[model samples]
Target chain A: MSRAYNFCAGPATLPEPVLQQAREEMLDWRGTGMSVMEMSHRGDEFVEIAETAEKDLRKLAGISDDYAVLFMQGGASSQFATIPLNLLGDKTSADYVNTGIWSKKAIAEAGRYAQVNVVASSEAEGFTSIPDQESWDASADAAYLHYTPNETIGGLEFDFVPETGSVPLVADMSSTLLSRPLDVSRFGLIYAGAQKNIGPSGLVVVIIHRDLLGKARKITPTMMNYQVFADNDSMFNTPATYSWYLAGLVFKWLKGQGGVEVMGEINRRKASKLYGFIDQNDFYANPISPRFRSWMNVPFTLADDALNNAFLEGANERGLLNLKGHRSVGGMRASIYNAMPEAGVDALIDYMTVFAKERG
Target chain B: MSRAYNFCAGPATLPEPVLQQAREEMLDWRGTGMSVMEMSHRGDEFVEIAETAEKDLRKLAGISDDYAVLFMQGGASSQFATIPLNLLGDKTSADYVNTGIWSKKAIAEAGRYAQVNVVASSEAEGFTSIPDQESWDASADAAYLHYTPNETIGGLEFDFVPETGSVPLVADMSSTLLSRPLDVSRFGLIYAGAQKNIGPSGLVVVIIHRDLLGKARKITPTMMNYQVFADNDSMFNTPATYSWYLAGLVFKWLKGQGGVEVMGEINRRKASKLYGFIDQNDFYANPISPRFRSWMNVPFTLADDALNNAFLEGANERGLLNLKGHRSVGGMRASIYNAMPEAGVDALIDYMTVFAKERG
Candidate 1:
């Protein structure tokens, strides 16, 4: 079957091989005579899938025994409330950096649970860049410091990890997980919505330090409590089994493509190719600063605004789809997540070049 | 594919046609050139899938426009906490009927958010039967009357809906939703985890009256708020898209099977055939009262305790899988959900009769 180069930001593109395998296994998974959707989460078949996926993810991220990786539901937007509900231990305040929409949402949710201290914010400059660590004024008594590693909407990303001193560092990595290798020990908790780089939309993956467990507030729902999830190994209730299985397939695919390190180099190359092309052409331009521009999500706009609709229409005709930016940010965004091939970026550049030449 | 009669409580058996169709559409849904898993929830393709699923579910359940249907995540267990968080508006207490494990769980979680008055409980008799509604002393000032219409683990079901006077009646139809037809107007709210009769494991369907909207507590998470979900058309966050899509397929298939009314007749026949066989044979017995016995989940115990493992092993050899009962209630359970064919039940009865004759 012919496939299009899809650039949806989250609930985004997945490897064609994974999709094909899922299709082949939809009726009967490996002679189990049941689809993964129909298998009990507690069943041996699904348990192995869940455990192997966890192990593969731990290996890919180089997560140690010191951290517990939780496969949860409700996505990262739910984690905005869940993080504070699980992590705040006697501390009434937490520090947050407002880099873009994601961080802003997290901060707002955390405020409902604790006192939110905005250590740094780039809202004044339209969230184009992550504020420098030296400019941050983190509270010494704060329970944790939260930030969005990559914001899908504005295409802003932090190039460096924040220094939180003794405070636990939390990150919403929804847009950039598994695109590169990173030290999992640097952050106390890392949560991601599994729609961008991961497999599907329903599941969220959370990696929390073992030390951070068992601190959930009394009001936290049983499903929202990370401590309860850790104790039960994320099976406090029936998990998003099929989504978790699909994520396992994605993890297996990533491992086959040579772990996160090799994927990181390829991702960097893809990002540079597209950004380099945009820089060389005056007709197209990216708004975010080069230092903070997201490698996974590239937001751009045509110099001639009137040609935008025609460009997207023509791109659709060429089998390039969902290049529209977030409605909150009116522009074009090509989310080149880990699953996206470098050839997709090359094709986008080729199509953009033709569209500009025809319209300019 | 060589299929087996799967008796797992949940994620339970699904229609073979649904699984086959899912496989066909796994790669390219209606020639969209993108898998349903990859589509953006906000994109037109997925939006239509979500809307159609909701509409089909509303039609199948005979839900009125006066009620809102919410497709949510985290399962029915999460709703145990979320129900009180969303509905305990201006009231300190709510009435709950504890029929079995599911009821106890919901009561425990709701206690974290409100004053739970368990007006009726069958736990003293080891949750073998549903308590009679006439024995229930529901509080007139209570926010809502909560009960599990069918308990999966204990195989207990309410023969009649409880009369709550002014209090809104809320039912957890998790184990039995869409297996039968009922008047939607009788209950203020009805919720079911999709793992049973609906579709998959991750998604939960909540049908709530229009009057119940905008009543969430201050501490309710944005993702957990009913009004937020209803107002946003259940897209308050990235929903369980694939699960929702599969549910739509199930709903479509149910409609093709002449809706819930036809399904209910077939289900009653399947249940009666199995129950009739068990009741007529002295070697097998079901403990629950006949009136309260769950039609979807038929839990039966062998007369001799020594033969339990041997019986399961023999059943497995005969292609009956996951028939072992929930550990909380040790016995054999055949979860003949809406998807379980009458032939599967016949096969199970055939296997059981042979086992009894061989070992008698």
Candidate 2:
């Protein structure tokens, strides 16, 4: 098999050119005679790599100097705790809009530290649709408003950023970041796990408004404290250097492909092609509300439950790999991230067409 | 330059064969048609990779079933807080031995969660020697006794593991683990950042006795809880997948070199050759107590500090790299971990001899 379409949600597929460049430099990064993994975090070479990555990301995301972008470890799940630890200054509560599984996880973890106010929830609707912002029962004393911009498991996404006004807005953008242009100023903080659209597992990129710093609770582990990371340029300890370097390569590739604006256009087309097919076919159906459907993850179900395995098996046979849905959510999900070329989606749609005709 | 000897403490040099194998598999791992970086953490391929690495490490380190080996992130610095959070169940204070920078750091971080009792310290002695275990003021009510087996910056090492009777003994073996064979039964938990003798920088290998799990404080982040990781098989969150895979490759390479016993012999010889040259040469001197000299990191100084830059430049021209000492302790240091070949150490000795002859 020659680089089958990997749609594993995350640890998702990376660009082929990025992988090729990484391979070429694995033994000797340029003429350094050492792999980037072997470079010191404090050394000039790695510092340059780390800086270039942050700069490229800022340029791509349109992040301003008012925000400090941190290259951190332990993924977005770690940030679920980190955000509340660093943001809940003297407030007794924080508002959360529960859209799906990822949102609930954040709410549960934040509950350990502060009073969690569920302003709105789509769980009552089986997480297939986003609750209208007008229906929110927000807290006046809340420190921040938190929401999941894209839920990877349930294929649900928020169509609008909540208007938090004075309260800071925080978003878990793990599956959607770098897939399109984003308004960095709309949120007080935006964190995304690198595996999906960024680079690899274990690295999370955090863009935080500088004013949010210096508010960490006393019990917060220094490693999880945003200010400590901000002060050290995210090199307070030995960071995941290799992963950081790879992310820089990804940013370079994204630039070469004309930035996130271009990626946004391509991704919307890919998602539309697959979702369009799902709606037109009687044998397949997607449960997400059309308005709240994710452009990165498309979850669909077969008309007959028994044919699901056959659908997946046949898809794999055609080199469309990892089309299996998340274990928590039953049917099938196709995650078309930034690296998923339009060709991969075309192949998947072709396979789906053949399978539906044979099994319908 | 073609793969010069990297002597910075860590993210240190990895075995050439391990890097080569990783390079070959960077794009498509073992016919999976996806890089290991792109694999789902819960997928069969990555699960197999994760399990095999743990098994091989257990075999090499002689870890038993009573110990749950965890592949963790955030390096050893995170563990400085994690150890106290998990181990100080009902106890107020934990015993600590501060021999060098790393031990002091552990003590400082542990201070946040527990009443840290400095049982013994070599700080007054300039961290040149380890205080005898008999001199330690062991606390009867202490939760655990912690020590650094090797300090990368200070170039100090403990020749003997301290006896704390029934108190669980924890060792930060970040710079020394797997450089030699060890008695796993002597430790309650042994954690090492993987940049040194292991494969990469982002991953940390932890060998913790099962009895030590489930004691985390109420305020502990779920990501920091050892039991959560143990129960979830370290997939409680997405781990550093690529680093874990690279570590597995290094473990396989170590096995081919006849395991830790062979590595131990080679490491000893490498340390001896370098130290012997420094001692014999008048223009160079190593300040460590003879018995306490690190087998992994050798920090030395020139008789005239003025000649330091010239010495490093000459060595770099000969394809020897990263030999500069830590800024906190200015001089020259060569880190010879398990991956640093005996020939590299020999090359360093030859360069040191010539530098002495030229500048004496």
Candidate 3:
């Protein structure tokens, strides 16, 4: 079967090799006589699978001993509520920097449990830029400061990490995670939805500093409480085992491709190639400031809105799928995650060039 | 490859045919040129898959138009929190019947969002029996009455539905769901984690009465709000597509096997045969009261505790695996869900009889 370059923002493109290996092992994983899906979470086989995944993920992210890595379910959207529920102990408030849709969502979920102080927001600037760190109005006794490093919809990214001093810094790194190297020590907590740059949709990776545990409210569900999950090894209940197994395969693939540092270089090159095309062409425009342009999701609009249909149609014909931008921000978006080969970006660029010539 | 009859309480056995089909379709589903995992949740192909799954699931459960069927993430564990958050709007309290581990968990999570009144409890009976529904002390002004129809851990089940009059009844049917037929109209809400009698662990099936909509607390996550899931057709976020798709396939398989009515008869016969073997011999015994013994999960123990390892080893030698009981209450458990063919039960019986003959 000829596979198309899937650009649809996640449940997105996975490495073909991972899919092939999954197919090969679908019936019998390591001759275990059962697919990973059928394994009990407590079984030795699955325990090893979960451990390997956490270990590989830790290695890839350069995580330190001070952090606990958790493989959770319900995606990053769940973390929006979970982070605040687990962290907002006795504290009635937290600081949140609203960079884009994701950060806004985190803030909204946090609002359920705590009083939210909008530290800074890029909405007034159409979410095309990240607010300067100096503009943030952090709360003195806030439980934590939350932010999204990359907004998948607005294609805005933070070029530098924010310093929270004594206050813990939390980030929803769903889009930018695994695309580059990260300084794990800088954040008190980091959570990412696995679909975009990691592995699958159901599993979420959360990296939390060890001290963040045991603060969850009495009412927090065992599954949602970070300490319960950490103590139970994220197997407090049955985990999304198949998704976790697939993520391990993806981690192995990342290791084979020379780890995250090498992946960062490749991602940088691919983003530069595609962004270079958009910047040079008057017919197409990515409004995000160059310094803060996202390396993962690149959202661009055509000079003429009428040409949008024609552009998407042509791209589809060339097997460039899922390029439609988020409905909230109408335009085009190509999410070039770690699994997206440079060739896919080159193909996208070639299509963009051809589409520009015809529409210009 | 030699296959073992996995008696895991959950993330349990699937029909061999379903596993084979999933394996065959792993790389490309119906020549769609993409793995179902790779398909965008909003794409036409995945939408069709999702719709068909919902339709087939509705048919299998005999769900009517008055109840909205929602596919959600976070297993039954999440629903423990979401249910109270949604149903207990202005109400300060709800009635819960603690039947086993799952019900206790549900009660604990609900307590976070509302005042949970334990109307009945089987824990004092060692969780081996379900309290008579007539003896329950349900509050008149409580928002709803909650119970677990079948507890996976203790293998206790309610044989009769409780009478709640105009009060809504919510059942977490995770283990026994679709193993038998039920009058759907009798309950206000029913939810099942898909790992047991359904398909996979990541996806949950929530059936809520139409009248229950719009009652969620303001802070409920959009993904957790049943109304939002109902309104968006469970596409409020990117769902666990592969799990959802597999569940649909299982629903179709169940339909092919003469639907829930016929399947229920088969399940009853299978449970009776296995339970009969254990009861007839003093060496093997199931502690659950006959009426409350779960048809889905049958937890039993040997007359000798020291023989546990030998029993499991001998069982594994004969291709019966995961027979060891849950660590919480150890001995042995044989979860014979709808997917476990009668032959598998016979095999387990034969193995047990042989082991008893040798040990006795």
Candidate 4:
């Protein structure tokens, strides 16, 4: 296969133009006579690259000067501990909504440092729906309210941001960021692992309001402390330079495609078409509530579990790949991110239509 | 210029062949129809790539089964904290040697967690030479004895591994790990940032004895805990896939060039010729004692400080890039790591000779 519609969730598909530019510049970046990876981070070339990347990211996301953007490493998992270590300064506990696996993981890591108040939980409902915000057990004394706007594995997404006035709202927007327009002021912090929608696996982008910068616990590792990065412009130590460069390419690609507003409309169409196909076909079904379905990742089950392998094998016979669902979830998931072309989603739906007819 | 001799300390030069292979496979890795960055980290293709890289690193470094090799994120700076967090279980103190800037940084970060005992320091001598081991005051109750085998900025290297009887030895070999053959059995843990001799930045390769695993403190982030990565084979979260792949290519390139013994001989010649030229020329001077001089990073000064920019500009025109030394130490540094060809060293020497003849 030359090039397939990759649905591996993450490290997921990247825009073809980004990959092409990266390949063209792999050995020599703009006549510098060195690959971006080979250039010193402190050098003029990489510094400009880093600065331009940050500037472009701020422009595309409508990030205000009130926020400090950090290009960090160790992915979103590291942020689980880092968030509490930094944010829970004088506070004893933090409020978290257990929407799915990602939210639960964040909650579990935060539990080690602070008393975690479960504001709302959909785990009891097999993570098929997001609990209503009105029913949430509000905590006035909590440092912040944390939630996953979109859960990749569970294929569940929140219809609206929770109302957490005065109390900061933090989100693990790993799978949802850059997919559409976002109000940056709505959250105290937004962290997204770059593999899905950004560029690559090793990098995680953190956009935190400046007020949340200081207050890291003394025990927090210097690299994990947000203030340290904020002070140094994310170069307190050597950052993931290549991953950061690739991410910059991705941000450029996003801007060229008319930024998030245009992406939001296209992504909506892609998700609705696939979800519509799954609903109309008797042989296929998605478990998530309609209002809570994710635009990025669409998970569905066939009429029989025995046909899963055959279904995947046939998909691979065509140019579709990594359609298998998460190991914990034993069905299929098609993650159509910003990079996943609408044609890819259409091809997937067409394949599903044929498969349901043949295997029904 | 198509390509130049990149003398950056790190994100340093990578072998031409490795970069070539990466460029060719950037669009689709082999027949997978997806870039390595696009593959699921748990997928068969990436897992194999990850495992093969580990296997090659182990074979090249002569690592035994007693060690767990981890491909981690956040570079060597993260390990400065991770080493103490994971190793300082019940022990109140750890022993350290202060060789140069890198060692001082490791010591500073470790101070956040434990009683850091500076066993010996060459700072009094301006980091020109390693302190003699016989004068060292190591602690019997120390959790571990740590040292930097090579100080990248100061251009200092240990001629011998510190002898710690029962105490496990830890080494930051970020600039010197695969430059030659190593006795992996000698250390409790060894870590090198991938930017230097490995592949790219944002990835750190850790080799640790199995006995060092399972001793992480309660406060240690799961990502920082050696045991978690050892258990999951470093895929607890998404690893740096693209960097790891490039590293595998570097390892393969090393093997093709006749393994570490051959590299050791070549690296020795590369360093010797550059150092020899500097010593013989009155216009150039390397400050470190000849015995303690680094084989990877050779920091030198000019006859006059005023001519520094002229020297650098001239070198740049000759397609010799990043020869400017660390800002803290205002001179010239030619970091001739394994990827830096002997020919690059020759070219640097040639450029220096012409500049010296004009100005001497």
TM-scores, all candidates, are: 0.99, 0.99, 0.96, 1.00
Compare the candidates by DockQ and give the number of the best one: 4
Q: Write the per-residue lDDT of candidate 2 for residues A262-321, one digit (tens) a residue.
A: 999999999999999999999899999999999999999999989988988888777788
Compose the digit string of candidate 4's lDDT tens values, residues A146-175.
999999999999989889999999999999
Clashes of each: 0, 0, 0, 0
Q: What's chain A's TM-score in each predicted model? A: 0.99, 0.99, 0.98, 0.99
Sum up the clashes in candidate 4. Answer: 0
Model 4 reproduced share of reference interface contacts: 0.87
Model 1 C-alpha lDDT per residue in residues A1-360, reported as the tens digit of each score: 368899999889899989989988888888877888889889899999999999999999899999999999999999999988888889899999998888888988898989999999999999987777888898999999998989888888889988887999999888878999998899999999998888888899999999999999999999998888988989989999999999999999999999999999999999999999999999999988899889999999999778879988998988899998889888899999988898999999999988888887
Reference-based lDDT, each prediction:
0.90, 0.92, 0.88, 0.94
lDDT by residue (A139-180, candidate 3, tens digit) is: 889999998888888889899999999899999898888888
Interface RMSD (one decimal) of model 1: 1.2
lDDT of 1 at B292: 84
Give the 10-residue window scoring lowest on summed lDDT in candidate 2 chain B.
B351-360
lDDT (tens digit, per residue) of candidate 1 on B1-360: 377888889999899999999888887888788888899899999999999998898889899999999999999988999999888899999999988888889999999999999999998998877766778788889999999989888888887877777789999998878988888888889999999999988899999998988999989999999998999999988898899999999999999999999999999999999989999999999998888889989999999979999999998887788998888788889999999998899999998899889895
Model 3 per-residue lDDT tens digits across residues B272-354: 99999999999988889898888998988999999999999998778788999999999999999998899999999998898
Encode model 2's per-residue lDDT on B1-360: one tens digit a residue: 699999989899999999999999989999989999999899999999999999999898899999999988999999998999999999899999998888888988999889999999999989999988888899989999999999999999999888888999999999888889899999999999999988788888889999999999988989889999999999998999999999999999999999999999999999999889889888889999999999999999999999889999999899899999998899999999999999999888888888888787
Output the chain A TM-score of model 1: 0.99
Using lDDT as the yardstick, the better of models 1 and 4 is 4
- CAPRI grade of model 2: high
Instruction: Give the DockQ (C-alpha) for candidate 4.
Output: 0.90
Candidate 2 whole-model C-alpha lDDT, 0 to 1: 0.92
Q: Which ranges in model 2 have alpha carbons more than 4 Å from their true place?
A: none
> lDDT at B201 for candidate 3?
86
